[model samples]
Target chain A: MIRRPGDAQFTAFVQDAWRPLYRSAYLLLGEHGAAEDLAQAALTKTYAAWGRVREPDAAYGYARTVLLNEARSLFRRTSWRRELPSDDLPEQTHEPDPSDRPAVLDALRLLPPRQRAVIVLRFYEDLDVERTADTLGCSPGTVKSQTSAALSKLRRLLGDAVLPEGALHD
Target chain B: MTERLSALLHDEALDVPVPAAPAEAIIAGGRRTRVRRRLGAGAVSAAAAAAVAAVCLMPSDGSGLRLAPDPAAASPLDPAGWAVSAGSTLYLGNGATAQLPDKVKSIYYTSAGTVVRTGTVAYTDAPDSAYALVGDDGRVHSLGLALGDRAPSTDPRLPYLAYAQRRGNTGHDAWDVVLRDVRSGDVAVSVPVDGSFTWGGWNAPPVALDGDHVYVGLDDATLDVDWRTGAVSTASHLPAARFPESTSGRVALENRSGQPVRVAEVSTGASVAELSPGGGPGEGPAAVSISPDGRFALLVPWRTCDDDNACVYDQPASEVLQLDGGRSATVDLGDQVGWTPDGRLIRVTGQGVDLCSPVTAVCDPTGIRLGEGPVKVGGNSYES
Candidate 1:
């Protein structure tokens, strides 16, 4: 073992980061099972690098970076790409058609994995462009371009009627 | 549309269920990755081992085979130097050599021993090809071909051959995984595998079996079949769809998504070296092969126009590194690099076929120089 972070501290980190991290993973990969694996893997990396992290408080951020790296690496693999969930929504019991999942979800699915990751980090996680770029290991300009491309593609797929000028903002 | 998209994603993400975090499993797995990596590097007595790092490399006796600064040779396929096998015949230079083992198609090298894959006509088209384990001591054991259209995977750590044999093609094609104990000539375990008969495509199930677990990769999921208990379970951390290669079930090469390949050696449990593709372009390795001793790595850097968007992987350079923190140096050379049963590396450079120190990357050029510009390395070159 390279770095031995205390068990209590590691457990505490997992307990706190589990939900949010897993949620981020799910948003990144769009699959529950994969999201869990990604979160677990990210946490594992965080634990391994715990001793190397200069700032103890920044461990969560370090873990998130690892998670993003794993997700991006996974994007390069065809087999992992196959693990993408269908644009299908959860089954509704007493509701309308399950096929009624929004066209935008399908558009998000159609977007490249990194672009989708950018969208999830930007909108879902509500992280700033800089933070998103940092997470993705890309320049802010690249992040903006990715965001512009992703939003343009999403808008094309969903149409202007569904998106107002400032509706995507916080 | 952006607002709607965000709202839909927000709603759908909430709908995505997060399974209970297996805290123990996560912790255990993390430790496993760490432990496996440590194990791969071999146990370090810390302060003491660091002291012994020096004086590790001395001039060698060449272990019955040594190449000098530059050895001369004529043909790359010249069998006069080392034994080469063609079909059922072995060659000693251009002349007919001793007959190869029965049903022998080609010979390959593993960290443990020489692996001879056998079948008749055009190299074993009889459903699957079997292997003959020729021990370093020169004892030969022939393991009959399995049922499927693929050969068995030998466990580098043990003398076991794991293969999936055909059982039925009716309904869903059924296959059974067989683990043969090569020395005893005994079937260690024969367990039936789930899923239809595979036609052997990209999505075909991977048959990586050993004494412990038989990894059965199906389209929907990948499974670990316990050969001993016959218990099948979902492989954790491992993508159920892709069956990664494991050296000891502890450390494995996860044929990951991106180009920088990953080796899942338990560094602490879940932490293995996830090689990041850094450096400008071809400077990063396009392909990486780890030595069985876990001491060295053969890194084939991404080459030529491969860095550009058009990408041509015509790079013919492979480097040997002492990745395990030993006194090994990075030996760089032309393409076609492999390992001998013993840990020596074999490289077919334009100069000649050379034996290299895995750690020092220094090549002791064998006299077997290649005159044929650049010829493909045959399976026989695996032996030193």
Candidate 2:
């Protein structure tokens, strides 16, 4: 193997960025095995281009972009296609239980790939419309529309007490 | 409610179980990638090595198979010479050549190197079609991509290969315009195409890379995608449905019948020059090719053949039209023609390749010949 001085730096980056990248991947993919595969693929691609990553501080951003791209690729699979959103909501009312995190996760899984991605990038990653659109490789208008659709689905899945109608405005 | 949902989402992400980071695996994969690019250092995969062996063992008389002695240091637009492929051998202009195991289908030029699309057959797109990059050092490195039949585009200044891939496995109309960096073999950007596909008879949409923007040909409109910023906009000035060839600031618009008719400004639909005469059927030329700088256009006229059963349309003649001045000069077209990076004209015949000056229409022989087989020139050779 060709050894470079950047190997140690990349190893350090892997240790630091792995969990956050994995968490983002998990949020986007909504499963452990797919999330792990997506995260590993992103990190592997990041390692391949490590020599071109000029700033060490920007490594996380690069890996995150790659992770999102990998998730987009995963969304093209047959199983992911089966998760496309339909007009009819689930029969059961997803009342917010004491542990509301599970309810939120369930609602997230019901969304289409692009809509789910919009939700994760906006609320979880704290990205605005333009930045989220850039990350998702779409326009700000698309980000806004997908965000609106995903929030509507989430509101219907979870009761109004957990997510009020006013939440749609923001 | 928004804050609560955000907090819950964060908590939900954090609540998931995590596994140990596979540092060794990632590092090893990176090392493999690095090794694959070091073709000059004699590091190649076993499959690529065997393919090289197969190419070397092909029948040749040791005539025009010379390898470029030094790595290319010239600008891509001002290439040292022309490159062409016959059977399995690539004849790099000026006595340098490289042989491949598969037949060369099409060739694309980039600042980093010359990329060739290879398949088992010459003119047919198959499932086994692969791409390889012939570096300036005269070494071929496999890109390891088998993108099925979708047309990919490259610019003379950029090192990225751009193409369109479907966004879903269920055969949806959505697509993502993907750009892969040639040097690193990593996907630099994947911009999702916001529009639906109405373009019939294509596996996916065709892409044309000019400077920073790649033009995707759709049925309703041509999408001007910025590879750097991932911005998608409509190139409303160009032709709406048919594919257009984009260069510096000019686009060659295809007519309703998918034949080249005129060159126009990409910003506005103003005509730069008429590629063909405006009246009557069968008046259009057989093929029209624009220069890399978008300053000149080559129109190869069709000729009548005595034999009906076995006939070809492209004659051994051409009219070189200067788009800026509206003046044209007739030149003798060889078997095939393409443009150099510096906007010079190149013609290839069974005898050899010739460098032609577009202004004077004078052809100068470069003394490159590959015995006997079908020859495909680079630049615009594969254009129809």
Candidate 3:
């Protein structure tokens, strides 16, 4: 368990929130080192506002929001670049058989930060367009447009065999 | 797609190892980030910055921006050293020597001096600092307040600095814009404001010291705060735009529209000085502010992913618009230091501080260079 700094409840909170937030950060950033950094940074930001966070359960969401915003800022700045999508497949790994599962990660890396974020929130987080819009600070129109564009890119990268074109509209 | 994605994510989440929770670290980092954000005046305004953000992120080769390691050698800090950040080591300008505190979080270069924020092991951490202003004369005066490191902008001609401060972390989160007389080392006046914009490419500090009066922008409104008296009044009739980074609140710049068109006078919506920006739909311009001399407008056009059909994410470009309404010039900037006192556009690239004069559109061949390799961070100016 992560030892809480000043409060007793925070240790349990961090224990519960760690994996999920790390997972989201991993998906959003598409790399291990950056993902860990992003998750930890988000957690730190949430910790700074622990008093203001209000509800104990909402800490994860707040941390996730900070992570996304920080990721957005990092990407928005020129120092870091998000990986673009590729038509080429990855080099063979030592593992046995491979499905297109690995391609999803690669394909996700290809999407721009904002579009990738929209997909993660809308699909992975199971958020509605309105909620996604609120998270991204864009209108529902932008959310819809980004989702459509991101889906279209994913479809192209993954192909109709794995991701049927008609099915992505949902 | 959603079901498969969910399942795939579940497996992926399980695949990654859960490291021991670093709760103490998180708390420390959080506090530092809060200080940086609050000090930046940009942390609280993510939603606001997003609301007014343009979709332009130019394509870059990522050739120069060094987020990695550069060699350590004993080299005199030059004028270029004033603007670069390599790890925790700040390249003190003009071959000067001063010990930067342990766990420095944010570094703000003001006209009066350079302010260093010290703190711990957070993603970014600092010493418990109100903030320390190291004057050009080599005196470091501790303000003992949580003023954003780079939030204060000083006038080159005068000894006045304008900045903003938020109340305590919780409860009533009231924000105040303040003016400090650098000569007297006193806060001349403090005006209450509704909101503050964060630090990034798109926003500038709203509080500016122009002559005797200070101009500031609140969310959707602009106000002129008197320096002599704490009297604050609305610069009524200015367009509903953010002047987060303008020297004169009398005029504001924003990019909700197509290109980054300048709102001539905030009080009157007569827009002028529209530059021919090289961008598509969401690739409009933002992060716009005027040079200290008022001769040029600096804009960093945002590159949006909305237009990426291939999901091709790339990095690149900075633009300068002539305030006289002439053509704009594009510079290949990797990292930006604020404008020099003489108004030379200084950019730290793979090379060093290339001081480019806007009039000639020519950069000095020889400029200050941070030691070779990747510069960890720092080169952000408070003027921004």
Q: DockQ for all models, in order?
A: 0.13, 0.17, 0.12
**Most accurate candidate by DockQ:** 2
Once fitted onto the true fold, the runs of candidate 1 whose alpha carbons sit more than 4 angstroms away are: A1-170, B1-113, B118-148, B166-175, B181-186, B193-204, B209-211, B229-231, B249-257, B266-269, B279-283, B302-323, B326-328, B350-352, B366-384
lDDT of 1 by residue, A1-170 (tens): 44677777788878887887888887786556667777987787677557766776888888877676655444433333223222323334654443543565556777656667778988887778866654554445556766776676565455556565554433
RMSD of each predicted structure: 18.3, 23.9, 21.2
- Which has the better lDDT: candidate 1, or candidate 2? 2
Q: Write the per-residue lDDT of candidate 2 for residues A15-38, one digit (tens) a residue.
A: 999899888988876667657766
Candidate 2 vs candidate 3, TM-score winner: 2
TM-score of each: 0.44, 0.53, 0.47
Clashes of 3: 30
Residue B171 error, candidate 3, Å: 6.6
lDDT of 3 by residue, B1-384 (tens): 456655665665577665677777665555554454334212110111112222211222323222112211212222333434443344445444334444444555455555555543211111243456656544556665554323455554444456755644622224566666544557655555443332111123345555445555444344555544445555554322333333433333433322344535433434446544322212234345565555666565432232111111122445566766566666655544446544556666664656677666577644455654334233333221
- TM value for model 3: 0.47
lDDT of 2 by residue, B233-306 (tens): 77777544344458876765554333356667786767787654323222345445678778888775532222
Worst 10 residues of 1 chain B by lDDT: B46-55
Ranking by DockQ: 2, 1, 3
Q: Is candidate 1 or candidate 3 better by lDDT?
A: 1
